[model samples]
Target: MARDRLHEMRGRVAIVGAAESDEVGRLPGKSALMLHAEAAHNALADAGLGAKDVDAVLSTGRQTANDVPEYLGIRPRYLDNTQMGGCSFIAHLQHALCIVEAGVAEVVLITHGESGASRVGMGGGDRFAPDTPPGQFEMPFGIGGPPTRYALAQARHMHEYGTTREQVAEVAVSTRKWAQRNPRALMRDPITVDDVLSSRAIAWPIHLLDCCVVTDGGGALVVTSADRAKDLRRKPVWVLGTGEATCHSIISQMPRFHVWDAAVMAGERAWAMSGAKPSDVDLAMLYDAFTIVPILALEALGFCKPGEGGAFVANGRTAPGGALPMNTNGGGLSYTHTGMYGMFLLVEAVRQLRGECGERQVAGAKTAVCHGTGGILSASATAILSTER
Candidate 1:
């Protein structure tokens, strides 16, 4: 019955508009809320719609749900502030579909913005308070922030599968190759596997080059029923399927150190609903908060078998001219990563399908798989987007 419901939901909603802020890197001047409003306005204009046309609003960041709609001067009939960390926006796509299908709302707007580098308007607070689960358990063990926590998994991946550091470095090298084609990317210079290996080491097996860049940016998406999307300004990028799952909140509690079971569950559900396999994916936008994240995602999402992701990405397979283009926008590794990066993944996927990516465009890309990992592999969301309904 659940399978039938998922099949029925396929292609019922489409993303009509997508946009990022006017500027995406090192914006200490723009407050987090300001970035949100700018991206929201641009997306509405992209859809040839006004703020008044939106009946639903969804956003996640340092701000509250009421704060976003209020600042946008919108009184949405529906509102969602589901905060699942970086993957919140991708999960929002799933919520929007359900809302539209149930006739609860139409023309849903999902937005995200953050001041990761400048820390302009982000209120003062320790992410992991003394009383919090992470503060009590993980942080006390000197496992704070992404690098230290993720190192545990990266080292385990190497121990379990003979995955070499050179193979991991290839991910950074290949992603930078794509960044070289993107004028908007923060890091466009060519890099070799040796460069990544020689870069500063943040944690065991995780080099500085393997980590995502810190920037200030925002991105937004507009979704509506498939019927209404045909009348919008841009070509409707159909939302064929979406799935989200969670495994653990703290890194210590992760079920398996090397594998991302949450991503596996999400990807399986997404593939089942879309009726598309990894073989059918023309492009992929897997989150790259760290190189290992995408490598693990490749295996978890069925792009490659477990323990084979390092090999899958080693030979420029995900580079600009590769057979399967991944992270054409340079990804969080080289592109803008404003704390939460899943929204940008969706924006790039939509633009690639619309043939608006210019030099970085993947020619004849009809199907895209966007997968996001949030909070130390604690949460995962997968979206299957296509040019066809």
Candidate 2:
């Protein structure tokens, strides 16, 4: 089947189980592989299944399909290793839906783990060779890291849209409000815009609070055919639609700084596939690797117009009491960011749809939209989930 034709997948597959590894804030003793195994076990338990029940496996990061299967002691007929950074998990979920709907896998386990805080065995180096464009041109000037590259876009957004520093800081302040209700959140203290502005600045517009917290953690999901999910342990969170796209690998190659073209394309496809408009969405789990990301995503996802994201989030619309509740689980900014945050986004969305979030739940939420950005806003993926059949 063609990848673009995901609308046919609606109500065909559902997420039956989801879980995170041990406490997210810190785990100095745990290796990345250990975290992955823990999450996989937890998710299987949540689904009332054992490793033997899983006939397929999907994962990202340094771990290959073979690595995960070997560590977990399960042999699967199908395996997927689609790693595109933070949004890799989102893409994996999308692929798993197709795999299951095609009758290739009865039950699939998608997992993610990163010892970002400990950095124990976390390999790092330029993805490109020394003589490549990034190595020869961009890296030579010392403008390599994510903060520097994202700052260029944030600065441009501020200039083009007259977006203020306080408007950007509002994202942090609002997300922290949700974090206060989550016991597992790393940073739950209440923060005002003034507090965010006063915090140390990482880049010009990106402050310490504006950036996502890096911790050691892992998360996993159990997906199966809708027919099979109904017989499983937990309520089904249907995969209504999914879309993914890659714009560029290097920041310099991006078409526009103010707008993420890939996000726009991906979101539009997801919305179309789900037959859902922005108004139909009850909640959002947009990847907040940085405050600016959700801002751009809100626009690209059609929640608001271009250049209007600053105002859309300024008045607390994304806060707990707002019309459109977003990142109800503190999000990457305040919750936990273990490098690739896409898996957590789906986990929170599933919980929200299940009405499991005691304090931060969007009352009567039936539909959710989870969006993820990978590699300096280069790769984008969007998933629409609902509790409806």
Candidate 2's TM-score reads 0.97
lDDT of 2 by residue, 183-214 (tens): 89999889999998998977778878888999
Model 2 CA deviation exceeding 4 Å by range:
1-3, 123-129
lDDT of 2 at 56: 91
Which residue pairs overlap in candidate 1's backbone? none
Colliding pairs, model 2: none
Alpha-carbon runs more than 4 Å astray in model 1? 1-4
Error of 1 at 59 (Å): 0.3
Q: What RMSD does model 2 have?
A: 1.6
- Model 1: per-residue Cα lDDT over 61-165, one tens digit each: 877789999999999999999988899999999999999999999899999888889988887667799899988887787875799888889999999999999
- Each candidate's TM vs. the true structure? 0.98, 0.97
